[model samples]
Target: MAVPAGVAAVVREMQDRLDAMPGDSPLRDFLSTYQRTTTAVGQAITDGVFADGEWVEEWDVVFAQLYVRAYDAHIDGGHVPRPWRIAFDAPADLPSLRKVLLGINAHVNYDLPQALLGVISDADFADPVLLGKRKRDHEAIDGVLASRVAAEDDELTATGGKSLVDRVLQPLNRVSSKRFLREARQKVWHNTHELQVARLAGPAPYDVRLGELELLSAAKVADLLAPGQVLLRLAVAGFGVVLPPAA
Candidate 1:
């Protein structure tokens, strides 16, 4: 499948995938929420929510392609990233929330930096003015994601039948979602810088750094699978992985 050309295309692709999925497929959980979020993002772009709406639209398309490619790879029996493999292969019986969280873990922690790198160049990074605008627009996405959390929770509840415990923790979940997305994107920016440096150094260094990111992302997903309060655990451990120095 081709990478989407814009946010509207991204939303449509996600919806198409969701339509193709079986009703009980765990994959639908994330794709459903993601589709709605992407729709909101498209609307935001239309409403001039970001400083550079065009850049955001381009970046959003690039960012979404990473997830789309992973889904395609998994479905086609091709090579899928470790983090995405874990998420895609997770048991269908997993909670809808866990399934969605797993997808977010793989996409944000592993795919996001690469997506950032795709659109942001060495010159763009070096230019403080350009980079500042990019960062601000990147941060602007947090508002989009944060805005969808409550509505997403409601959707999940309607589908998955949340427990009383889940109801009690919904407020905390909303706050945690916002906090972690902000924190994760901050780390994503740092990781993108690390990746940009490695990319400039050469393919060898870039591959090594990317390999380390794969491991860190996979490990984080594994950690997330442990039994506990997912939000609380995420608050303590944080989201997104740091890229280690190239060996």
Candidate 2:
């Protein structure tokens, strides 16, 4: 299916704004990566990469709407999704990459599963063949993610000069980034299934499960920004100090 018009407009607006920002700005870097991923997903939908390309396009729009809400909230000093609250609340001095990762964590871990259900019907879950096809398509985005991240690495390194810590993380990131995406995507599937099960049980159970997912994401973000991790975050911030600003 073609990319939804609404999704296209949202992405275009984001890309335009990101284009207008200073290249070295943390928000610009975050939105640059986000825009590239959205563009890839849009192309994938147009190319019929998913068996249910229409559903995939709808899911992309639903997922992006949540980000738009969070971003607007951040700008207007209004409420945001709890996980995104952490990202917006992060210290201004935090490393640019970490800022981007916080947004990724909130969006993927917190918002993706909820968005998944919005795209597929409860009946769609019953067809094993169809389910498998949708899942395969969902999982295939890992390639898109890997490519986008690899291409963005130079910009990240330029923004924050690599440190010993970054070097140590390099081999691990190369090995584990796709693995991480796969695991995260799998968890989203599982969460969607669990919510479906809970819905059959009762509203109370469904609500509780949803709350648990939100709490889990909040705790994960807390760990990411926890005091124990401060030194590493600060180190990355310091890495950029000696480097000249982006042109």
For model 2, how does the per-residue alpha-carbon lDDT over 77-155 read when each residue is reduced to its tens digit?
8987788888767876766666766777788888887787777677888889888887887887777787776666666
Error of 2 at 112 (Å): 0.2
Task: Please write out the lDDT profile of model 1 over residues 70-156, one tens digit for every residue.
Answer: 999999999999999999998777778888899998999899999999999898988999999999999989888988888998987
Question: How many pairs in model 2 have backbone atoms within 3 A of each other, for residues 3 or more apart or on separate chains, i.e. clashes?
Answer: 0
TM-score of 2: 0.80
After aligning candidate 2 to the native by TM-score, how far in Å is the CA of 196 from where it should be? 1.5
By lDDT, the best candidate is: 1
Runs off by more than 4 Å, candidate 2: 1-7, 16-26, 161-164, 167-169, 227-247
Q: lDDT values of the candidates?
A: 0.86, 0.70
Q: How far is candidate 1 from the true structure (C-alpha RMSD, Å)?
A: 2.8
